[model samples]
Target: MKVSFLIDNALREAVVNSCIGILLKAMDIECKLDNYNFFYSPSGFDFFDRTRENIDLTLFPSYNVNRTPEQLSRAIRTNSMMVATHAEQIINSALYKEKLNTSAKSKYSKQITSHFVWGPFFAELLMTHSSIPADKIYITGNPKLQVSTRLNTSTPNLSPSKSVLIVSDFSLGDMDDERWSQFKKRYKANYNTPIHRHYYEARRKLVNWVLTASERYPNIHFKMRIHPGEDRAAYELLKGTNNISLVGDRDFIEDVLDSGLVFSYSSTSLFEVLVMDKQVFNLDLHDLPEERKGEYFELFEWVNKSQFMDILRNYDEGKVFYPSSGRKKLLEKYMYGGNQKAVLRNAIAIKDVLENRIAQYGFSDFLVHYRNLCLSLVKDKAVKAGIWFNKELGLQNYISTLANRRKEADLNNPVRLNPNKIESAYKIASGIVTESEIEILKNNLYEIRKEKDGIYIDF
Candidate 1:
């Protein structure tokens, strides 16, 4: 049987798919993995070329859910299966609530053949709220967590540089006028809150706070890692300062592992740092209304400038900054479950679906498929025209060049895993994949290699 996994985003999806691919190949299963630019790809790419390939199953990360599932269902043969994995372990509280409410009224479960989740928390969340059947919701854990844990243990021990790392998320300042206007419209419609404005105000306040804190502690070097796809020029002010530095084109996990202290305004990295037992502080500088505050923030220690300064001073004096017992418990319960065999479990679940061990859900009704077909036809034409126009104007080449540059930046910040630990994890998970195959898979997963048609996974 042949299985294909789609690579939507390089940094996030590649590692999980690589592990799955190796495991499948080791089990005498054929697997194909490739990258696709979600925005530029034709709407019916999944359907148009389905007949050319003999794929029995396709595994996709969460981003593919934006479009109707008919795109896959109508394209593939009736017997083929489609599986989805949650992109992140923790679903944002607001989005979670929205899903729960909508699931109560709609049968959105028909959207996919099978759904793989992080743990009991997510599985339970879906079972109780979503229309997806409990049996179909397999708790495979998160394969990415396994990689993160392995990387954390394998990382080299370096002398403490007494550096504090600040991680940034997207803000209004990061967007151009046109993009900001579109974002404002979408944010207002979906959230019913002024997220764009609030984010701008909060980010500005937070940046000011960091500058002030940096001035107070001149000895401790402060580094800000701007979020990917953000405009680095927005942070040009930090360039002139000696103590403050903007560290771009670096892996976030590597930064988290290396830093003496990590700070963010409720980023997912907080959970990652906590899992590694690192000192992480949350800067609650985003001045959102009480109702708009996400529940995820409660997991971190919120500190203002004065409290942050105190923590830095204590850390500089060789004092250990311990989180509250409550925060530690929260981290243990939600994020880190001490399981490093997620990849193996994920592979086994895929195998089960492929072998008919797990019951599969059916596709959407004919009316829905017809609607999708009509919408896809229009979209496909628009995309073709856009591509033709871009090529005529040399915009296609320029865009491709920019993408290659970004891919190169990602390749430089490679994740080095402990070879011995990787074998151990594979053995523990009963993975039959050979060590050499796993190594080759890891090397090619994060880098983009060009093909005659487009960029493809070398592995």
Candidate 2:
């Protein structure tokens, strides 16, 4: 049996999925997994020399599959049993009404064999809104948050020195056409303000506050981890302060765990810190719409720039107040099982499906797999030929036009992963998991394999 995890965002999902990959491998399943970019993108053919045609099961990166037609069409065309496993777990009523409704009512959702959700909240949304069968909804916690407990204890995640980490969650940035269209509608409805103006206005204020704070406290180091959606170059001017460093490419989980103090404008990542019983601030520089506050308001300490500065001053002086004891209950209420063995739960669910797997027309699928393998070789050759011709011959103007024919920019997610990285992540996660679970996989550690044979792909 073959399974493919079509990852949407590599940085966020890859590590946790690595945990899942190992579990599936232990089940004696041949798993093909990577960023959906490499699995579906035109340039992806470069890294892949063979394809596993007609996969037994394909787990898409997010439930928002309707947002990307190209990927959706390709996924439907290629896979046998499709599962909608979400990467984005933070869902509010407004967000669900605006974004997820399209996915819920989508034909793709109807075709999906299983719909995996982060919590009961998401499961209820799919059940109520999509009218999907109750049996189909799998309430798996967000994959990343699943491994949070193990990752939290990973000593390397702890900082060597005290540093302040400001998670910048600005709203304006590159978006898919569907989301962009929605943003336009929201912009029109809100009289020219962006869809999430509160995030924009507040994060902007927080940025200025940090710039001044970084100077005022030169001895303290501050790292502004910019939002993945926001353009990093937009904050180039803020990089002048030596005490503050604007970053985009580091591991957010590790950084969050390492930081002495953590703050964000409106990101849900702060909850990961809260899980470790650490203090994190949600800087509400601008008043957030009551509807947009969502369930996290009770778990996180919502404060403004000035209030944050006062807290920071206290933090620097070695005094800080942690989140309330009641936050544990709120976290549990919102996070379903509140950080249980989600990776194991996901692995077990996929395993059960595979164990009772239906027989596909075996011979035809064998032929199809080989055919796809051959076609992958052809695609790889063609991609290499194009690259050689463009770079070697210096024919940019012509190649640019051909490249524009493919959605290269859209396929190019900010973070990319390779087998070595995935393997390394697998090893790291293996170490962090419980000893008994490690014993289960110890015999099969070498069994973990991927569909394609490339180190990495750069689109």
Candidate 3:
């Protein structure tokens, strides 16, 4: 059997996809990895679909449930099955609840939970929301965990090393600062507890704290790894006096696994570290206000002075703590309260559904459908916006090839100001009216008629 993994980014696809490839290879199945094609080939998304038709199966991994299951199901088409691994709680949280609407909510809640899904706690979700038969859903252990074990076993003589992993948040509106500020104001007024504000304040304190620690412990190295989606400037500003090394885009996960201790305030990467059996110190400095404390703590691990200092001292001694035997224990006791061992255990039980089972639709079929829909929408939006701007600015006439000829005539003869060319360029450049942004060029002709104004622009 042969399989192909289709993903957008290299660093983003490293963990789970790598693990699945290794596992399938060990089973004597040919695993081919497709990467960097998106960068070199503009039509790579199209080429990927053609290639998918020849594969035995293709895995489309996703963490969030932003699109409907039907949308997901129809996107990929081929002779092979499409598999996805989803983490339920992360999607069900209040953060995602706001991003989805009533129809999207019903679709995701209904069909997504039914298919070949893998995550630590999925049983409860499946029991409550899914309508698909139980046998179809497989709980292949998180490939991240399976792959991490190899690192420990491969090198029995590995020595202790000090490393700190930094992760960025999915802060509300890091894309546009103006919109982010507005969100901050509304959140402050209504909820009285802004999540991003707290996260920023904590990050500020932690960066300084890390700098102090790095200075004091010269032997220990510090590594800052920013999230892919985070605003780079915000991260830089947060690093007050910290002159530590930064992790490049591709080195994030490898660094995390190799670290002696992981220090993070609110990143989900901390959970990944915990799964690696490494010591994780969640630096919860200030207490949340009474009313918001309960919900806020769910997103972060509460770290007091005693626990923080103890973990720091322990790291200096070359000792590491796993905290719990498995994720079930760690999550059940300290994180979300439950006997979630069944959920964890079930996740590892089914791994062969993709091998012999028939797919409702193939990978190529889904990819072509999704790719066409997306490209069409993107092109339509771009053209419509360009037309609207062109018309509103009154620059329509300047867009014609004739306008360039008029400019050349004036360029050759410095003594003569060509009214036609001047007017055409002006109309094209000015943002005036939708009917003929071309009209502004006419205004330029008026400027040129005053021949004494000798400043000229070449076409």
Predicted candidate 2 versus true structure: per-residue lDDT over 200-238, tens digit per residue: 556567767888787777777898887766867657668
| TM-score of candidate 2 on Cα atoms, chains taken together | 0.78
lDDT of 3 at 6: 53
Sort all candidates by TM-score, best to worst: 2, 1, 3
Full ranking by lDDT: 2, 1, 3
TM of each candidate vs. truth: 0.73, 0.78, 0.59
Please give, for residues 1-459, the per-residue lDDT of candidate 3 as tens digits.
Answer: 667665434444444454444434434666654431221111222223444445555555442234333234333433455544443233333333322222244433432322433332443344344433345455333444444444444434232556656555535325354565576443222334455556566666766676666666666667776665455665564344343665545434467665676776555555556655666666775444454333324535567656666666777777766655554354443222132222222222212444346555435435646765576445445444544555577554432223244335423432222344333323321321112212222232112110121111111
What lDDT, from 0 to 1, does candidate 2 have?
Answer: 0.63
Better of 2 and 3 by TM-score: 2
Clashing pairs in 1: none
- Model 2: worst 10 consecutive residues (lDDT sum): 450-459
User: How many backbone clashes are present in model 3?
Assistant: 37
Q: In TM-score terms, which candidate is top?
A: 2
- Residue 336, model 3, lDDT: 27
